[model samples]
Target: MLFGPRPSCIKRLLVIEDDPLTAFDNEHTLKHAGYDVVATVDSGEAAVRFIAAEQIDALVLDLGLAGDMTGRDVARLARDRGIAVLLVTGRCPEDASDIAMACLDKPHSPSALVAALKALETMICKNRAPRKVAGLTTWWRPAAA
Candidate 1:
């Protein structure tokens, strides 16, 4: 241990999206943005399996997934395991702020998605307030002193 604080790095990610086209785009965009896309799954079951087995730093989860479990279910599970989450949907769920680090609305640009993740990383890992970015509703707050 040579450091006072661990490095703030949010790298590996799992994307759970029901739409094949959107999933592809999210995976492609995140990889281009320098994140390791560990896996892109289309259902909650697959997402659960990945969550149980993989070392994921974050999730890009679609609210309406193609399985019994909704994105909120995955978000809760991921949070229990200390993984961060970024929920994506047309309309955000009512309890989104409780379960995710941030939420992003649908039909957003790839650049906007990338920016949202950057902002989330700053807030979650760096513990610093991030500048506002379009299409992101952040839920991260600094821990109380």
Candidate 2:
């Protein structure tokens, strides 16, 4: 629990990365940036499982998973459930499909990741959800609360 208190107080992020090293680095960076990482799954299947069982506020999903399912699939699932998403990939999608809260390309620095998370938090708060996006999202009506 990086942000502290509750999931609502810390922007909860679900990471679906296929590389263990990258996932670890992203988790560490996100923790330092004050986010609560709900789950770090290496495959799209696990990502779906994690989301189904946890209370995730947003997703930092990799476009390439180790399994058959892609990040876009996970994004679609999350969007269907009203969860915000941040796509971490090399190329950005061009369509007006379900817009991700933000997008970060590969080889991102910790500072850049932190900034993205902060930006995503802001976007989530501004989405007419009556949520608070202070140093955290504790001001909103949390899903678990």
Candidate 3:
């Protein structure tokens, strides 16, 4: 009997956007792209809490949040935990380049967002890291050590 290869693991994603409509769009885009959006929050504080409690594969964050903590702060925390991060913002910050894997401009098309996420996913996979930003039939496997 022949059997197919093992299935790839699903990646869990967290989205943080202050605007309800924008947050909804992000969630929809991620889900439509085959990512499992574990949770969507509007404030940095909530994002931090969610990160602490969940095994997040990646984060899709907005720079300006509803709480005292900024998206940069959350990104910093996530990076420290080895979680991949992508910043989606209207105005990209000079410092964002240091914390996130990539920064995406606002008003982006869903396809653009999916592409960005796929790029991030590729980066993470290259490092033997891992997200569900897009459905990729071909994935990069890390070379043998």
Candidate 4:
């Protein structure tokens, strides 16, 4: 039998923000928190591709991206792919869409984002068993940890 140790539990995240300053700040903070930032893009289109390519465990998505597609669109796509989402934006509550994970308004401190990500990570970890949602069973760990 081929026996090997389970892979490391490094969490991967994708950041989709249009503002240059915000993107830089978020990338710096998330990296400092030990998340593997797979990709940082200014457009929702690019963000979608990054999620598709990487084993993205979560997303720190902005509500306003610099492209025809909005951040909500990116969130929806990511959710469909079983990627946990954390919405950070200055937009109003009513503007929020059907995101699965935590949501935080913009102008938030790095600590706040980190807390939300941690909660999302815990939620994902607890629900590692395969679940059928929307008639689809998304990829999830076997609670081996």
Candidate 5:
């Protein structure tokens, strides 16, 4: 019998922000938090293309993008694919509550961003089949049983 460990599924994240600095910071923060940031793009069109091609698990989006298509438009596409979306913007839109998993205002600390991602991860994990290990519960799947 071929015995092997189960593969771990780390959540894949995509960051869509127009600002170069903000995009870099968000990508760095997500990577530091142990999430795989698949891509960091500055336009809604590019985000759409990336989402279409990549297996994105979650998205951190900015409402105001440099392109004609805003983050809200991208959020719709991401949500349709069952990807968790977090809106981070300087101004919160009224409809934001309807679309995203959560909204974080701009000037948010890195800790806040990390906390939001953790919360989203927990929520995602809870929705799936759970497993217990060492007297604790985790949503992460092991490589082998």
Candidate 6:
């Protein structure tokens, strides 16, 4: 297996953020946290193509991408392909729970990001809902799924 059954299934991540600084920071942080960041792209189009070509375990998606395709577009494709999505939204990002695992609002700490991902990993692996996280609102409907 590419990844083992434990520690963990959420190890491979694809970061899709338009802001170069944010992308770099996220990549650095996730790497420091021991995740194998597959790639960091700044456009939805690129994200889509990359997802089609790679075996990513999850995504850190920014809704306000600078490309022909929107982040929602990428999320839909990723979800349909059974890849987990972690949304990164601004102050008023559209609620896209239908296509995402959870939403993490902007101006959040790196620890919060890591917490959210761990929560997501638990939810996916255990098939249970996650508890509340700071600056995060989960829309995962595990039972319904």
lDDT of 5: 0.73
lDDT (Cα, 0-100) at 16 in candidate 5: 92
Residue 15 displacement (Å), model 3: 0.2
Residue pairs clashing in model 5 are 5-143, 5-144, 6-143, 6-144, 7-143
Residue-wise C-alpha lDDT for candidate 3, range 77-119, written one tens digit per residue: 9989988788888877777767887777787887777777766
Candidate 5: segments with Cα more than 4 A from true spot? 1-10, 127-145
lDDT of 4 by residue, 42-135 (tens): 9998997887778888888888888899888888888888788778777534544456465676788776666666555545666543222221
lDDT for each residue of candidate 6 in 6-122, tens digit (9 for 90 to 100):
337788899999999999988887888888899999999899888988889999998889889998899999999999999988853566778798899897888788878887887
lDDT of 5 at 83: 86
Best by TM-score: 1
Model 4, position 140, has a per-residue lDDT of 34
Q: Arrange candidates, best TM-score first.
A: 1, 6, 3, 5, 2, 4
In the predicted model 4, the residue pairs found to clash are 89-106
Q: Over 4 Å off in model 6, which ranges? A: 1-7, 92-94, 143-145
C-alpha lDDT of residue 127 in model 3? 55
Worst 10 residues of 2 by lDDT: 133-142
RMSD of each: 5.2, 6.4, 6.6, 8.9, 8.8, 3.9
Candidate number with the higher TM-score (5 or 6)? 6
- Model 4 scores a TM of 0.76
Write one digit per residue (lDDT tens) for candidate 5, span 21-81: 9899988877776778999999999999999899988888988898899898899988888
Top-lDDT structure, candidate number: 1
lDDT of 4 at 132: 27
